[model samples]
Target: MDLLSRGSMVSRHGLVLLLLLLIGCVYADSDDQVFLEINDHKMTTLSNMSNGSGRNEQICTLCEDFASQTLSYLQDHETQTAVISGLHQVCSKLFSLKHQCLTMVDYYVPLFFANVALIQPEEFCQKVNLCEMMASLRLPNRDGPCTICHNLVVEFLTKLKDPDLQLEIIEVLLKACGKVEDHVQECKKLVFHYGPLVMFELEKFLETTDICAAIHVCKASQGAAVAATLLADA
Candidate 1:
């Protein structure tokens, strides 16, 4: 080819390459900038959601009080001193209050579980009343049924990372459920439902060298069985 023609063709090729590079850079910058904006918007939405969230503080207060009162009733009243005494009236009232208080706890307990470590031990003690009361009442009323009232135990296991607590809770629950023939059916379903999830966590917990951590995996496995038994026996 002639020198002039060759020079013209080279100039055109160089210009095309430069144009393509500029177009590619523009698209890359646009994508990066758009992704940053999306992330920033998500952060802003999350912040607003957090700020606006509030729980039923009134319900929480009542639950705490009723649980405390019921515990005090057990401590002060002791074994039935007399069948005809007005102490029976107080006991009835206290039991009634405990049941009512658990309803409130059911609504607010998830919130408490979210930040469980920050909550005072006394608060946890009060909350334990709700679990114990629900487990004890065996109420016929379907208003707020006892479906996995031990959810707090599972959550505690997840956060506390203690196997002994997991096993203790499992044993206590097994003892509670073993008494009731009616619980067999429900326990069977529960076993299938929560078994795999807790097992997965237990497997993870087993990897740790800490004895305390090791205990959790062992207990979690038991706890899952206890949960299964609840539905199984029903």
Candidate 2:
């Protein structure tokens, strides 16, 4: 199975991806049940590609492919220029990937879905004229939980060995949701009541977070600094 790593070779259309059908994970129960089976799930490829189950391997391979092939499709056809372009600027920075990695559909899919509930990603997909194309996949449907998205993040955290870079990306996602400052105040208010706990929880939630990991650190850092000052003043 092909993987997403700094040194991994990416075929333009992921003919490697084309050979497989990526089945996105579906919740048998609830979000809380997600990690219950973490032990059963195979070690991610980054850690030990040789150790995981066929299913887990498929998830990693497919996800890597999804990130690759989908973006290739979009780029070739000019699917969602605005959203695609915006995500390009963000994902590469967050994941410490080259700008070329923006071609990975799986990389940005969760971030896109992260906004769907609150921001209606459909609007952006429509803007890019990819609504119908995405729906045809019949993967998780509209109301499904973000299981697949979580897996994608783990692929990055596990596959990419730079813990500092991973942590940075995770922080960007948790606080900035794409690492963009568009909603820092909302995040600040949530963290204000339980800053340490929220930070801790965020660490655990790193794998499954829906944050877009888009913005520059300065954007979120400055906004967070201002919020802290306001809280101190109060």
Candidate 3:
């Protein structure tokens, strides 16, 4: 081919290469912008959380109060206390934080409701009052019978062996649950469905007859706050 013709062909290839490079640069710029936007959004969310946005001041104070109350209950009912004690103690410590206090409360508040949602005074009349005065709460903006209440009572009656200890537990649960009204229905359903399973495990634990079974029971129940606690952690 002639030198001029060869030169023209090389120029055409060079123009195509330049266009490809420009397209790649445009994509890279678009990707960088997206990364910046995402990073900025994440930072804004973290900032809002730090500022306690959309959080109630009352709930913040209650978290600390709850931790204190649980510690007190555990201290008072030393003999009957179990894993629920440890969960409160940790939550108590976490509650001391000025930060994320409401979120922690939000986690625990529902479990308390579920813990005592089933007890009925009539049902437990022959037995201990698992359904004590505190247990019979008419949650605000709530109506209808609990879907899980009856089965929960049955489980409490048959599956749980230590009636006295269980009484103290239900009382403690009632106290916490009584204080918080948020997510009452949802938490009750979660516990009502899952509480029997947990109790089944606890019932098996109780049957072990190991001297340290109480300690293990306490460990297992850590989430009653354990149920709420584990579910919250999840």
Candidate 4:
């Protein structure tokens, strides 16, 4: 080939290479922009979720209170006739969501009484999904139900020296277990079985003991942190 043809061929190849480089740069910039946008969206979503935690907590408190009140009423009026009358009285006193509360009581009271021996007020709230709603709103890095149960039990053991606070701690731990999802039944069972013992034989259980493992929420072979992460993911 002549010099002119050879030079023309070289120029064509260089132009093609330049076009390819330009396209590559454009795609690189686009990818970076997309990545930034996705990260920004995640941050915003997390912030919104964090802010909503307060509202969730309030709802959870209401559910717990309702459960406690209902249980008290039932215990006070154990007979079928009294329970029927008390249900309406309880619903009337709710002040908020009166109609809905009545409906819920009508629907859940039978189921609750049927399993009354195995379930507590907190567990009842969970079975009805009121407290479970709060559990669903748990934020990133927040403790899972099992971890919360473990920590509360440990706290109860540590504070066993306070006679006045023993029952209060047990109640709080039981309520916390009600909000648990993955191991709700197990948590409640453990709390009910061991909670009374905590008050009676304080010397038998130690704060250092692995209560989570005792309840089987955490396995002996697996780390507590690992079990917690698995539960949280579940």
Q: By lDDT, who's the top model here?
A: 4
Off by over 4 Å in 1: 1-160, 183-196, 199-234
Candidate RMSDs in order: 31.9, 19.2, 28.9, 31.2
lDDT of each: 0.33, 0.32, 0.32, 0.43
Query: Residue 77: error of model 3 in Å?
Result: 11
TM-score of 4: 0.26
1-234: candidate 4 lDDT, tens digit per residue:
011112232232222222222222222223465434433443343343333333355546645654564455434434434444545554465455355545544654554454444446566554444453344443333655455544445433444556545555455555444333344454455456556553444323333244455434445555365444443454
Q: Candidate 4, which segments miss by more than 4 Å at Cα?
A: 1-141, 144-146, 166-200, 206-209, 223-234
lDDT of 2 at 183: 35
Question: Between candidates 1 and 2, which one is better according to TM-score?
Answer: 2
> Considering lDDT, where higher is better, how would the candidates rank from best to worst?
4, 1, 2, 3
- The residue-level lDDT of candidate 3 at 66 comes to 32
Error of 4 at 124 (Å): 2.5
Q: For model 2, where is the 10-residue window of minimal lDDT?
A: 18-27
Model 2 lDDT per residue over 1-234, tens place: 111221212221121121111101111122533322331232221223333223233333334433443444333323344444444444444343343234344453444443333433333333322323232222343322233333334443343444554444333323322222343343333224333343343333443223222121123444344334432442
Better of 1 and 2 by lDDT: 1
Tens digits of per-residue lDDT, candidate 3, 1-234, equal 011112232232222222222222222223465434433443343343233333344333322333333334333333223323333333344323312323434444334333334433232231221222113322222321221222222233342455544444333333233222453343333234334344444443323322111222234333133233222332
Error of 1 at 22 (Å): 66
Best by TM-score: 4
TM-score of each: 0.20, 0.20, 0.23, 0.26
